[model samples]
Target: MTEIRLITFDLDNTLWDVGEVLHHAEQQMRQWLDANVPEYTRTLDRDALTKIRTAVVTERPQLGHNVSALRQEVLFRGIVSCGYPATEARRYARSAFATFFQARQEVVFFEHALEALGELAASYQLGALTNGNADIQRVGLDRFFSFAFSSADVAASKPAPDIFHAALNHAGVAPQQCIHVGDNLIDDVHGAGSVGMHTIWVKLSDQPNTIGHTQPSEVVEDLAELPGAVSRIHTA
Candidate 1:
């Protein structure tokens, strides 16, 4: 294998507990809505919210790649459905999304995630490749990553080659010289492998490795083990 010159990461779950962050962010957004748009909050149910979101994605397929836009559009339609005029609905949508987006950046990093990235960044070019809307800059990880790409940036998400290819192009490295580290088996392992890049799977020790057929070059249960995994691949 070519020496690993660049290491790209999946932002959401690889470095932080995204599930907790998202749940909290959603709660924060709900509180904001309840305070500012009482009528919309009173009328909107889970089913109704899902319907609005679905309609937004279905009607405007391009928003599928842009989660932030998709979410704002959903909120706009939901508010308008509650009898707000288009201008007021648009303003409310932006404010609600701002609340959500701000809360979303309040992420708790996985144990030793920062230390691992700090160590690896010293020797290799580090980049972020994600399908989610999490901004590395807003997440306070911009110091470590030389570049970052999202589904919105490439108009395609992982499991497709667009994101991985964008990372390679941005880093100016061949696929063989890069390794992608992510928690998802298919998105991280199979996606990078398809483009001839190596992969390291960051599965928690307790999680079941159901997709064992999609192999990664390395596997680390903890972020502390990440640097060693990359080193082993580098020296191979």
Candidate 2:
């Protein structure tokens, strides 16, 4: 077996429960908007904002990869529609997005997440490959992750080959010398596998592997099992 030199991780659900973090962040952002730009809060509801997001992505498909831009554009449009001038709308949108982004970084890791990363980082170079807008620096994950890439970095999200290829290039490793660990079957398993890298599926639940055509080299339900799984793959 080729020696595994790099291990790329998905940040969102793999490291922490993103749904709760996002919900809390949204509330914090909404509170900021209400205090600063009451008009936006009064005018746009969740459904309305969702429709604007859909339109924004529809007109500019490239924004799909850069979620930060997509969200800021939505805020700008919503603020403008609420009768704010373009200049004020842009300023408010940026401020609101910053507030949301800061709040978004407040993540609670899964049990043993830090410990597992520490163990893995001792022997292998650790990288992060995420489609979401979570900043590793803001989240204080920079100590564990030597390099990080997001969808925005390569203008392509997972299930696409660009981000994985970027990691390979950055690490200077062949596909067989890398392993990608992520929670999603399609985005993590299929995506890395498509690029000829080994994969470990972080199955947080009992959901059956519905993607029958693709299989991960290892499946682990908890981060505690991560180092062992990687060791097994490395030896095999």
Candidate 3:
């Protein structure tokens, strides 16, 4: 194996608890809607909101990469469904999404994630490649990463080779000289492995081992163990 030159990462579960952050962000968005778009809030229930989001995604499949646009579109259509005019719905949608986006950036890093990033960044080029729309800079994590890419920017989500290839291009390294770290077995492990990159599976959930051509080269329970694990892989 080539010496690891660039270490790419998946943002959501690798560095922070995204599920909890999103829950709080959604709550904040709901509160803002109740205060500003009372009529829309009153008209749409939780189930109705899911239906509207589903409809939005179904109608606009291109949003598969851009989660922010997908959410804003859902807000706009939900407002329209509440009988608001297009212009009014557009205004409310922007405001509501702004509320959500702001709350979304208030992230809490996982145990040892920051220190691990600092140590890793000192030795290797670090890049963030994520399917979600989380802004590394906005969340105060930009200092650790040399570069960042999102599904929105590249118009291609992971599990596809395009995003990884984009990272390779920017870093000017061969796939063999890169390793991708993330929580998801498929998106991070299988995806990077398929492109001939080393893989580290952050086992945060009860996901089964991938049963295919790609598999993790290493697995660690937390970020604290990552540096050592990465060293082992690179030296092997």
Give the TM-scores of the predictions, in the order they appear.
0.97, 0.98, 0.95
Sort by lDDT, best first.
2, 1, 3
- Candidate 3 — what's its lDDT? 0.89
Runs off by more than 4 Å, candidate 3: 209-213
lDDT of 2: 0.94
Q: How many residue pairs clash (N, CA or C atoms closer than 3 angstroms) in each of the candidate models, in the order given?
A: 0, 0, 0
| lDDT value, residue 152 of candidate 1 | 92
Q: Write the residue-wise lDDT of candidate 2 on 1-236 in tens digits.
A: 66999999999999999999999999999999999999888888889999999999999999999999999999999999998899999999999999999999999999999999999999999999999999999998999999999999899999899999999999999999999999999999999999999999998867776766679999998899999999999999
Could you tell which candidate, 1 or 3, scores higher by lDDT? 1
TM-score, candidate 1, is 0.97
Model 1 over residues 108-160: C-alpha lDDT tens digits?
Answer: 99999999999999999999998898889998998999899999989987889
Off by over 4 Å in 1: none
* Pairs that collide, model 3: none
Question: What's the CA error at residue 98 for candidate 2, in Å?
Answer: 0.6
